[model samples]
Target chain A: MDVFEAVAEPTRRHLISLLAERERTAGELVDSLPALTQPAVSRHLRILRETGLVEVRPDGQRRIYALKPDGLQRIDDWITPYRRFWRDHLAALEQHLENQ
Target chain B: MDVFEAVAEPTRRHLISLLAERERTAGELVDSLPALTQPAVSRHLRILRETGLVEVRPDGQRRIYALKPDGLQRIDDWITPYRRFWRDHLAALEQHLENQ
Candidate 1:
């Protein structure tokens, strides 16, 4: 699964939000969501890691996870064009024409 | 599945990108993707509609689809916080502290 799929799960999105604030230990991540078990959190973390949306580093016994912003550039690039949908109508039309 | 899920599939992302350029009829979308069967494109369009990522309306005999920018706002909002991850180190640290 890519970053888009990795974030499709709400739990992973929550994990991302948590990491956006600061790098969190794996244990802290598990504790943040009381509804999920440690294994469930691990599963989600694994997806994020695999997708490159999050990176992990050894911190002795603990593993630290932080937002890997580069992985998100694809999503950002995809959404950039759609942003014109909300821009001034005249400007949008001009950009549209320029692309043609 | 929400907008994130709607866009998770590459075909759907392609559809969104097509719509981002301009509104397109169902047939146009199907034709743009040569490999996928018409039904497959229809199914993807259905999911896009359900997720509010794409809005559809009948234009005479054709159904036109366009990106529903409002639906993407949630994703844009969620990613806003993470944007700081790429900013200058000092700025990121200051923003982190401000949020605390």
Candidate 2:
């Protein structure tokens, strides 16, 4: 799956959210998502790995998962131009709030 | 459909990419994506509209489409925490480049 497909899944997105804070073991990730089973989390991790969003490193008995910033460049590139839209609107909103 | 389902389709993402530059008419968007037929483009636009990603205003004979920044807030909220990953790596990369 591509970056788009990888992020489209809410479960995978939640996993990314967890990793955003710090690297965690596969067991730790499974504990965070109470609704999902270990196999389901494993599948989600596989999809994330295939999409290049997450990297795994062996740490003796456990594999640690970490966020790969380069993997997110596709999204950053896609959203870069569009940021002006928010900046412009936010500036206006700030001015309006200041006036009020 | 929800935001996830709406953005998962590649045609819809392509339509969004076009609108990122500037607003366009239905005909204009159709012309831009030569690979897809007008009906397909219309369908994609419908999905974008339902997801609140794009808004439409009538210009007499034609409807003009524009990007809605609020629609993107969902993504922004989702990505906010993860942005630090890029910022940290980017700062390190910049330092590395400076040293070279």
Candidate 3:
């Protein structure tokens, strides 16, 4: 699965968001997603792992999942050229608000 | 449709990437995606426009679609907290390389 396919699922995106802060064990990740079953979260993690968006390190009996920055580099590269659009708009909005 | 649902499709993401550079007419967008039929591209654009990821302006006989940065703010916000993880890792890698 590619980055596009990995992030296509909202649950996976949420998982990425959680991992963004720090690495967590599979059990910890499951605990965070209270509404989702362990099996469902495991499936999402599997897809994320396959897509390179996530990496896991085994520590004893548990696996710690962490966000792989390079996995997100594609998206960052895609958005780089467009950053000016939002920055400019934000500047304009700030100026307008200052005048008001 | 919500942003999650709107971006769940790969075609829409590709369209978003194309629009990131500059606004394009519906026909222009269609032309860019030679693999996809005009109807299919149109549907993808419709979903993008509905999700607020894109905004369209009518210009005489054409409609130009442009990126709506605010629509992406959610993802940006979600990524902010994690930026340090990559930055720190990159810095460490650079230090290690310099030592070598």
Q: Count the backbone clashes (under 3 Å) in each candidate.
A: 0, 0, 0
Runs off by more than 4 Å, candidate 3? A95-100, B4-8
For all predicted structures, in order, the TM-scores are 0.83, 0.84, 0.82
| Model number with the top TM-score | 2
Alpha carbon lDDT of each predicted model: 0.85, 0.86, 0.83
Record all residue pairs in model 2 with backbone atoms less than 3 Å apart, i.e. clashing.
none
Give the per-residue lDDT digits (tens) of candidate 3, residues A1-100: 6776677687888898888867899999999999999999999999999888899999999999999877877666655676777788899999999999
Candidate 2, what DockQ?
Answer: 0.54
TM-score: model 1 vs. ground truth = 0.83
Please give, for residues B1-100, the per-residue lDDT of candidate 3 as tens digits: 6775676577887898889878999999999999999999999999888878899999999999999978776655655676776788799999999999
Provide the lowest-lDDT 10-residue window in model 1 chain B.
B81-90
Residue pairs with colliding backbones in model 3 are: none
Candidate 2 positional error at B19, Å: 2.1
Candidate 3 positional error at B82, Å: 1.2
Error of 3 at A35 (Å): 2.5
Clashes counted in candidate 3 amount to 0
